[model samples]
Target: MTKSLKTLLQTMPKPLFGMGAALGLLLFLMVGIAGGFWLFDRYNSPPLGILESLSEEVLDRDGNLLRAFTTDEDRWRLKADLDAVDPEFIDILLAYEDKRFFSHHGIDPLAVLRASWQLLSNREIISGASTISMQLARLIEPREKRTFTAKFWQMARAIQLEQRMSKREILSAYLTLAPYGGNLEGIRAASLAYFAKEPTDLSLEQAALLVALPQSPEARRPDLYPDRARRARDKVLERMAQSGTIAQSEVARASGHPLSAKRHDMPQLAAHTADRLRRQAPKDSVHQTTLNADLQQRMEAVVRDGADRLGTRLSAALVLADAKTGDILAEVGSPDYVSPARSGWIDMSRALRSPGSALKPFIYGLAFEEGLVRSQTIITDQPVNFSGYRPKNFDMDYQGDVSIHDALLLSLNVPAVALLDAVGPARLMERLRSGGVTTELPEGGDVGLAIGLGGLGITLKDLTQLYTTFANRGHSTILTDQPRSSAERQADASASPIPVLDPVASWHVSGILKDASPPRGAPNLPIAYKTGTSYGYRDAWSVGFDGRYVIGVWVGRADNSAVPGITGRTAAAPILFEAFSRSGLSLSPLPSKPYGAQEQTLAELPPTLRRFEISKSWLTNDSLPEPAPKIDYPPRGAQIEMTRTASGQVLPVLVKLQDGRPPFRWLVNGKVLQANGNRRKVAWQPSGAGLSTLTVIDSAGRADSVSIYLTLP
Candidate 1:
């Protein structure tokens, strides 16, 4: 063996032995500490759940605060994050409290020694040596008095906190627990209360004020004692200068900055909506909604003014949104959400009330689609009866041989009911519901023509949603305020799944309504609008829409008491117009006229279409007065949620027939499913997603189909 190799081998063992011995000792110490902590974990552990107790927040689409609810303790304590806080504030806080915060484990020996010396020399407690961790322990489990025994217990808890959490976590909890005056327990609440802003960005004066308030919150309340508060803040600024946390040149400027003595009220926009979301998800700490806070505030003011001017006991609600996406931008549930006398706590926008003639446009639009009439088609607007149901005009007079445009604009009840009879009432409501408009007939009521003229109860929201079909030029979107909902899933479910009318027909209908006369003294905005009054003046509604916006207003008493002289035009239309004017959005141009839309005089039109003849044109194609082979279970424009099996296969869609001859044939997406099956029900498995047209044909070859969207829940 070489002499050098032997010498190296002799020294390697000693070095290896020393390294192994050190690692073994370290492992043994860790095991011993783990055993000790396992015993310590049984009691006196930190209350970690306290960190999770936070205020419930409601924020608008742009993260602007709309409202917030205090915790059960009646304290506004929002979770604090180091990233969301101003770094300058952190620097000022640390410099004033614990300079060796980051370097120490839990307690700083230097600080303890200095505090001890100062106490001994002065024969009294001169200064505190509590690190951020120790302060956090006291905040979590506060002591009744500042005795030496309590201090030792706080020191113990401080060590536990340091062992259990990171330095950043400890500091964040401290920031969150730091008490400000008047039930504000966090930097966020304090900032919003005093400065009407967030803690994310702070001025030097603002940071100093915040840093000094937690020391003596009540005594230094800026709103209660401005002089003491100012002195306390200035002292913090002076300390920052002395410690060089902030430049000496900045102290005078910060001190000269004035402090706000008045406390701003927390935002209270969309009170009803916030309450709704809070009830929906009681445990959620934050609810992000698709609302514009500023617009909601302004809209509420408009509602408040309208209700106030209408005198006592009359409350109004306004609902508006982006027509294309159906994102509700503003909803004023009541004029004064807290008014006890008016029962304004109720959300009138979602309450069921008679729509009156507000639903007439949808009927007319459907008629135009079915080739029953055109904009200029002449129709008799006289008293009419369908079986036992007789309807008269709202003014108790009839227009002889009036154009469809005039009939609709006048909201003649007879003409509307006449058209509804020609086209099935069930069909009209089906189309409305297909477009996401919720309507309800009286209990045990059958489908009838009276529904065309305020015969059913509908919410203002559903009424406004129906107008979106006209605003979007035939397509409809479901209104929602939830941002987390999948818009793409709803839109991509099908190709115009809920079409109210064809583009050409919707254009004709919207054009006629666009010429509707404005309420007295209201601006002649480029929008198509209609108004309605319930049978007994219990509800008045007005819904209008431009190209991109749809707004609806309701004026009535919550108790459903009729108010004399309250008409749609006089009570609701004014509020609707005011909403548009105050919406803070410029009107978008109405949809362009469709290519197939053409104006024709009676003489130039097809002989059948020259006059009102609904049964002759659309029904003639099938050569039947009534359609047969009806699919009943899954209604038109219905969305069926299919379950997936463990094998990842979608369940089959069940189809039922209301009336059909025996030995029926079923087809799905034009593919034969059940051939010559006598049973009324059948199942069809879809190959993919999107709109599926399910058709059933009876022995007589009379066929009917219903379109539905296939989705998974």
Candidate 2:
């Protein structure tokens, strides 16, 4: 039995042998996976925890952000909304970060192997293989130290997070946590910072940029290294195509686009406003903005043109806001924004050169709001010394006993200063502050008469907000980033609706304020406008309004250098007018009359004088009015006989005056002589040399001069 059974004994326990083999294989496999995971941990350290919590955002009425991002100071963060994001973007990121993202539970075994091989070979650290879940884990539980042990922990944590969160949740966290560029984290913030738009609104080229950025946001910064960014963007597009996320045609088309971050061009004014709004909003919530992209572009162009025409290193700041919601619509901080070479330094318009008489409207407005002045009230436009501080008008011309309406319309510095003194600075400041102006005023400083004429350093934002109150009829709602619900807002106003100022006195003051606005010589579009210039020709500003929108503009050098000749009306007001004209919002015709209002009469007009409508051609004799014959001007160089009369020398020169008025004065040898009413008669004695040139000045400040060329041959 021993010999024969020996062979059988060798095969006595086949099942036992099989069990041992299986056990050994299982142990070997377990050890290998453990080692692989350990190695993965050693090489792949978790990301550092950057932001504490997700950033908040503010949106405009149409859900467009007035400003971008939510932060403390320059802190901006955003999370991608998958529904709003481009599918190719997600696919491209997945292709780069986790090729097997869909199939893998959380970790990719083959990727670990390749990454180990590369690390051991000392080649590039290319194989990330981080699934969406893994990225989420890193974001939630980031490592304090970058070490082998930390990486293993991160992998484990990633596995755990994958088990806890859904695929969509994981993707959202990665999108929100991924860094893009320059203090901007997450796809949402990155999209807006780079594109001035949301992730959902991203174009194909823009999507490629966002996806490419996660590789190395700083190195691929489109603004800084556009060439490098272009290369990276191209790579992303290639990968996206390979992944079947984008068509080859799409890739080619996207590749052709220049790697220009137009959206991220970072409008200087918008950025400055964003910074300011961040400070004003809740620390955690995003401040939505009311920025109008079209209007903003127009304002920028206007400011730029003004600066160019003035031939100075000028900067301008402007702000437009919705009267009903106090939502800022458009803003400009400077004439030139920072080029990448400028190191991203942006000048805030609200912080630029001091606003001159631009601030007068507020002083006068507050006075009117407080029932201190009426439109027809006579305000002496003479100079006055307040504690040895005398403020004079820009022209230094005195118009004694000018109506409040006229004084303000002309922006007379002395009159404004006197009114400011009467209203008191403390109260004025309070009113301004209440209305959302934030300029610093001198303490215990007697707001001299110049105070009413923009003697203080005010910002473009300050003036815009001040005018906003007037546009809203004396009651101002606080500026907000978010669109207000009907319940949240006071009330919605239709176009052309009369303002809702309360109390008869307050209403009267509003009227005075409106009346004080410069007569916009064009057909009345329901608008109120004021112009102001600083004394040194350093700054000029215009603030105006319609029932729907309030706009403010400033024209001045960024460095406070003088612009010798341009005035606010010439520079800033025209820009404002252009903006209004381009906006296509017709002015509501002026109301026939407000309810409960009575018309008041000023100094009676002379019975002998009556205004008559006449064609301009009739005045110039260019073409006659209907049913009238055109008359010729006295034949060029014709002689005139001067006969002395009691009223003046009756210099009779036959000239044509059709249906319209003509130059009242007759000039000889270009000498401008006073006109006796609307009569073209020149009392001239031939002067020597260049043939008497005669010129005439009209009431509207227009002049016509002609050379007689009197050859006394």
Best candidate, lDDT: 1
Residue-level lDDT of model 1, residues 1-713, one tens digit each, is 89999998987755555777999999999998777766765576888787889888998998888998888888989778788889999999999999999999888999999999999999988988999899999999998998989898788788889988999999999999999998998888888889888899999999999999999999999999888999999999998888778888899999999888988777778889999999999889999889999899889999998877665567899988888888899998998877885798999999999899998988888888888888778887653435535465554445788889898999987678778887889998888878866778989876787788888888888788778888887988778787845756366335348688889988988898899999998998888899998875578889999999999999988988655446689889998898899887989988998887987877788877878843332222333343356675567887654544335555565566744456788888898998998776666678877888988888889899889887652
lDDT of 2 by residue, 1-713 (tens): 69879988887775755777999999999999889766756765444344446565544445555444445546566656688787767766777678787777778788888888887788667566555676676666766776777676666867655655677867877888787778877887787677776777677888877877876888988878889999988888887778787899988998998767543533333565556666676564555556765666677777666555444344566777776677777777765666332212355455635567766666666555555555556666653546545565564346777776677677777667666776677666666666655665456655445456555677777667666655554555555434567655554333213322333433444455455434244333457777777655567787777666877887765555444354687677767766676666555422234355444444432322111112222122334222221222333454432222233323233233222144355444444445545543333444433455555555445555444443221
The TM-score values for the models, in the order shown, are: 0.78, 0.57
Task: Estimate every model's Cα lDDT from 0 to 1.
Answer: 0.83, 0.61
In candidate 1, where is summed lDDT lowest over 10 consecutive residues?
A: 615-624
Global lDDT of model 1: 0.83
Best-matching candidate per TM-score: 1
Candidate 2, residue 511: lDDT: 54
**Over 4 Å off, model 2:** 1-79, 88-104, 107-161, 173-269, 274-294, 337-392, 399-404, 413-444, 447-450, 455-457, 480-525, 558-562, 582-595, 603-713
Which residue ranges in model 1 land beyond 4 Å of their true spot?
Answer: 1-38, 485-488, 491-496, 601-603, 613-713
